[model samples]
Target: MRERKAAAVRERVREFALELPGAYEDFPWNECVIKVNRKIFVFLFLGHLVAGQGDSPPTVTVKLAHPEAHAHALSAPGAVPTGYGLGRAGWVTVPLGEPGAPDAGLLCDWVEESYRTVAPKRLVARLDAERTAPPGA
Candidate 1:
């Protein structure tokens, strides 16, 4: 049941990540990742998608370049710095389907932040422009 819930949340987050400009899915190192312009912005772990793959929990790892956002994300239960020295660079892993876990909205915001951090400046600017553009204009 927990895995099912986590998978649902993971799919929601994945869909949100893919909506960003230049964002696309990739499988490197046999792991799922969402990248923009050749740089990985989000790493998604298995969440009931492949049963018996392992005993690990479902989680999403993203780089929080902003200091306050980084701290806020770490405050969530089961949230932690991403390993393999990525933690030193402000990457955080947020566990899903757990108590005190952040909601899909917050996770999607972080994914956008991560996208802004790694995507080219032009792409980032384009995203910003699109956000501020008037409706039907």
Candidate 2:
């Protein structure tokens, strides 16, 4: 059933997001959230979220560094701007369990971008350094 499939997809996406530096999961408000430095960067909404947007259980919301990135995220199928004025600040909703949705690789990239956008400068700098560091370092 789709429910089982949704769970699998959510788990995969959750694992990918959590692997990022400083990323962690919590259930404040009983809602699944992924954060960095106690600041929310990703929210995983399950069931009836954004009703009519898609037939997906888990919809992933991320905050981008700039509103310009909004258009790019929304260009993907089943992706939309987060409502309640969040969209005005560069937030986007990515439907995780929807058919034709972005694969885990692309979704992980988005998660990383969102993490960098909201993460503290020190954490971001560390991530940057890791990228530039040699293979063994």
Candidate 3:
């Protein structure tokens, strides 16, 4: 049951990332790497952390922005401090709970923020141009 739910959530996330402007699939883990003009924006490690856990599914780490949100995630079950250099930048590692631990909306927002943060200024400007461009101009 938990596996099914986690898969569903992961699929939703994958779909969201697939729609990003310049996102693409990455090898070795089939990880989703969102980019803007070839520059990496956000990385999805859905199956990258499953070596030791065995039956338990791998964890998901989303780069967080607000200090409050980071704090909240750290207190949840299955949640842990993000490893590597992301910890210094306020990324929180939240485990996709059994069937229904992570909130979809919150995850979506985090994903979006992560993508935006790593995107280059020039690409962002291009996105803005597209968004603000007239319907047919």
Candidate 4:
């Protein structure tokens, strides 16, 4: 039951990550990651995929360029700096299936921040333009 919920949350977050401009999935090291312009912006870990992991919650790791957002994400339950020295570079791992985890909307926002941090300048500009453009224009 927990694994199912975690899978659902993982899929939702993965879909949201792919919606960003130039975003796509890649499996380097056999782990799912969302990338923009060939640079990874989100690393998704789904609990059910590995045997014996047993209800390990889904987590997303992102590199946050904004200090406020970084601090905010790290405040979540089970949230922490990403490992392998990525933490020093502002990467944060946020568990999605845990109690008191941030909602899907907030997770999406963090994914966008990561995208903006890693995506090329022109792509980021395009994303900004789309967001600020008039509804009908």
Candidate that scores best on lDDT: 1
lDDT of each: 0.88, 0.79, 0.64, 0.85
Q: Which digits, one per residue and each the tens of the lDDT, describe model 3 over residues 1-137? A: 77677777776776776566666655435766555556444455665464466565545566667787777767767776677667788666666645346766667667666666666677556667876999997
Segments of candidate 3 deviating more than 4 angstroms: 28-43, 46-54, 125-137
Deviation of model 3 at 54, angstroms: 4.1
TM-score of each: 0.90, 0.82, 0.71, 0.87
Model 2, stretches more than 4 Å misplaced? 1-5, 51-56, 66-68
Best-performing candidate as measured by TM-score: 1
TM-score winner, 1 or 3: 1
Model 4: residue 7 alpha-carbon error in angstroms: 2.1
- Range of the 10 consecutive residues with the lowest summed lDDT in candidate 1: 47-56
For model 1, residues 1-137, the per-residue Cα lDDT tens digits are: 77788888899999998988889999986778999999999999764332343566788999999999999999998788887899999999888888778888899999999999999999999899989999997
**TM-score of model 3 vs. true structure:** 0.71
- Model 4 steric clash pairs: none
What's the lDDT for residue 27 in model 4? 94
RMSD of each: 3.1, 2.5, 3.4, 2.6
Residue by residue across 1-137, what tens digits does model 4's lDDT show?
75666677778889998987888999987889999888999999764443354766778888998999999999999888887899999999887767788887788899899998899999999889989999999
What lDDT is obtained when candidate 2 is compared to the true structure? 0.79
Question: Which pairs of residues collide in model 2?
Answer: none
For residues 1-137, what per-residue lDDT tens digits would candidate 2 score against the true structure?
Answer: 75676667677778987877788999986878999999988888885657665645677788876555667779867787788899877888877656677777766677788998899998888888878999997
